[model samples]
Target: MTFSIVGRCEETGQLGIAISSSSIAVGARCPWVRAGVGVVATQNVTLPALGPQILDLMERAKLGASAALDRALCASEWSEYRQVTVVDAQGRTAFLSGKQALGTYHAVAGKQCVAAGNMLAGTHVIEAMIPAFENAPGHLADRLLAAVHAAIGAGGEAGPVHSAALKIAGEQSWPLVDLRVDWSDDDPIAKLDGLWQAYRPQMQDYVARALNPTAAPRYGVPGDE
Candidate 1:
């Protein structure tokens, strides 16, 4: 089972997704984002390919969130078993929870975000995330994480979650923030938050290093100065 949020930062035009699941390596399969395009989270009998297909439609075909999703689903032979969510750079959102969706599934859309979960503790788990995302401060990654925390507080999935991921696409083609906890006996969300905190401070520095190495910050390791 999986619970996820696909979001856009109106302030920065960044797209991202935060997700957690009872399955392992949830990051490797679900949650896809393209800078200046959109984000798609494909779960519930997860067809990993559907994620990229949706993104391709949005990026290359210049399709909006709903159109891209519709076309992608039409192409998917196993669409009925999938639960997917999408949010474009313009903040348009769409989602589908199939008739065959797992127990107690729910999906909700908010200002610039969509939260969804299958085999959840209750629909309230999905409901609680919307306000959290709208109100959270700091970066888009922080807001997305806040939504995930709210879902957990509202009683996340019907079962324990073993893996979690946070992905954000900025100006570059690559992810601005990509963090994952593949498997954890302890609290994976908490572990993911810790990783975010550690990465946040150095996020822009890494980007500068890639774009203009001479202007980038120092590595700060021994002898680097």
Candidate 2:
């Protein structure tokens, strides 16, 4: 009941994942990225724990994305019911679609991105997302927004999408961009796009505030101290 792309920006080495689901709060679950580590998306039956655990492996355990996934899946009893895709810091990628994952599911990997979906309109849903990410111009965040919108343009999920999320991690431990529409009456992709547009200008300000508040500019809507 979801579609997503996990990708890295070649110029910046930033990691990002964009996702939408019929389910609420996909942000709190499906996508995980760690700076200098890797990216993970856990969907289908949705083993939310796998997202973080895999990142731990990539970080602390020093495992590559494929090795981390292979090692983790080898020890799991529920592997047959979950779908997972991973992209490491090196841009190497891997995908798994469990046997019991519901409805038309597919995974497509590319130059620096991987697109995956289950309970989708068809395989082409994921197919359309890949080049959209690869070919999209500008920042990594914009590329991701383009990919999710392309997924929807290609017919999207089998049902109406109620929620969506876009997350990008830069050199910081925290996400540089994390936008979501936990529930939307209309299109969540456009909602997320609007959110990104609003947030993009302030992105560097937030980072600067964290790194060096003395030099960070205040937009002046609220108290500036």
- Over 122-160, each residue of candidate 2 has an lDDT whose tens digit, in order, gives 999999999999999999999988999899999999999
- Please provide, for model 1 over 1-225, each residue's C-alpha lDDT reduced to its tens digit, 9 standing for 90 to 100: 899999999889999999999999999999999999999999999999999998899888999999999999998887889999999889999999998999999999999899999999999999999999999999998999999999999999999999999999999989999999999979999999999999999999999999998898887799768
TM-score of each: 0.97, 0.97
RMSD of 2: 1.0
Question: What is every candidate's alpha-carbon RMSD to the true fold?
Answer: 1.0, 1.0
The segments of candidate 2 whose C-alpha lies over 4 angstroms from its true place after superposition are none
Among the numbered candidates, top lDDT falls to 1
Question: Candidate 2, which ten residues in sequence have the lowest lDDT sum?
Answer: 216-225
